[model samples]
Target: MGGNQTQTQFILLGITDSPRVQMPLFVLFLLIYIVTLVGNVGIITLVRVSPSLHTPMYFFLTHFAFVDICYSTVVSPRMLADLLSEDKTISFADCMMQSQSFTHFAVVECHLLAMMAYDRHVAICHPLLYVTIISSRVCWQLVASSYLFAFLSAIICTWCTFGGSFCGPNRIDHFFCDVVPVLRLMCSDTHSSEMVIFAFVTINVVGTSIIILLSYISIIRTMLRMCSAQKRAKAFHTCASHLTAVALLYGSAFFMYLQPPSSHRSLDKVASILYAVLNPMLNPFIYSLRNKEVKGALVKCRRRFFNHWQQRSVVSSRT
Candidate 1:
């Protein structure tokens, strides 16, 4: 219970300790991380460069893409390294840092999705007032609030988790220093921490989810009243990408964190991989494939990039 008995160095058991699967797992996660970076970064850049995407929806999307990149980077690279290396030890500071960063991104993303939903809600439900209501200044304020609140939330969570003493077995059961598994290692009482985490998670997850649900419900009702089928189709098309992103995020996140710490098992690592790794890698594809505007922007960007490369090649040949 005292500082003298506290252990600062913790060993992460990681996804597995199998020698045979190490290289394979390492290669697989490395690829996933690479794609996550490229995909999320591509979306962010595409939105920035494409003039057509200068709306409130794409504005929120750019921020969401950024968060996905950070969230994936927080765990995937470290998890990849641990998969290959025999030493999976992480210091107290590093583990807390990772958890805090991960939690911050996760919280930011949750509210961003809600704000995006509200953007869509205004766009569809109040078509005439959409521009005035969700103006550029308003969008910036929404994004700023999401990040600021999430930053504070992350500090509180990290404190709640690390405030307890870690004088017992220092081995973590997961690939990364997850809160539930890490809390299990604490020798001191974890009830308050777990309760605080539960409350934090409930407010963020459920509150944001409610916002999304209500926004969609309003959008749906507006869609139903549309006299023209084309208008209805267009509205659905607008929100589809965000809806897919929300589904993936909430489904995996709920599975990962909605339970008591005692209920956590090996399966939690799999859930972590789903949201933290796979979701980031999948979002770019989800948006680019489903949204015609994003697809058109991608095509335009590709053509410009290729044309520049071709001109440079011809210049080099002439020289």
Candidate 2:
């Protein structure tokens, strides 16, 4: 199809269209979005202000929190809007932008998790080399590469999706614009497009998953050889949090994207909500509540903030 002949707008049916469900759904999602913002922002602030969190692990965590915030923001606002709106429509350009941004940050997070796993592997398996291996420059490079490659991958996936013609029914069943849901709306054959999506997803999902698996294998092997039970317990405790996050994120993502687009529309929508909305909101708690270091940092940060406020109050009273 020619450029001028392509689709201009699309109707998003969203999770549902029932008048009875709108307000309840709106309220629920609005609260979730608020929590997502506060949680992610809190993690970023904690990482920035706490000197104890200046290590490589927290360095990657800061970026992960950033990605979570960006990813949730991409989907949540529009989703919240659609829940309350009668029409629930989005422009082609806007839909494409959402897909691209969502995919970019999501992929960045996938590889970032793998990188974090590798960081743990080095820390436990080779503590002597951890500092030299995961230096400040290398941390920057890992984060930079994640964003760079994820952007390129996002472009490819977006192109493959939008390149097809959308002459069929313009109504999307899901809450937001996604490659598979959008592909289902296309009048053109989606064989090539679906194949491209599959290949990219495999690389992004399975490829990173393999890295994480291998890293953990090594970490486990090294931990087993440790002389002290305390060392092993501490190491496993650190790994547990990242593993939980990876399971929640990748489990929902794989369920949503791995299968054919035509399968389980409602189920897929719910799973999408899990990863896009709930996961990000829960991540800060997962990392902070489970990890002693983060908890300590939060306590320290809180004290400093409270003391600063107290000093400011006293100065204002004197003035």
C-alpha lDDT values of all predictions = 0.91, 0.90
Per-residue lDDT over 1-319 for candidate 2, one digit per residue giving the tens place of the 0 to 100 score: 2253267888888888788998898999899889888998999998998999999999999999999999999999998888777878898988889999999999999999999999999999889999999999999999999999999999999988887777768888788888888888888788888989999999999999999999999998998899999999999999989999999999998998898877856788889989988999999999999999999999998899899999999999999
Which TM-score value belongs to model 2?
A: 0.96
- Per-candidate clash tally: 0, 0
Model 2 residue 277 lDDT? 89
C-alpha RMSD between model 1 and the true structure: 1.9
| Candidate 1 wrongly placed segments (more than 4 Å) | 1-5, 306-319
Clash pairs detected, candidate 2 = none
Lowest lDDT sum, 10 consecutive residues, model 2, at 1-10
Deviation from native of the Cα of residue 260 in model 2, angstroms? 2.0
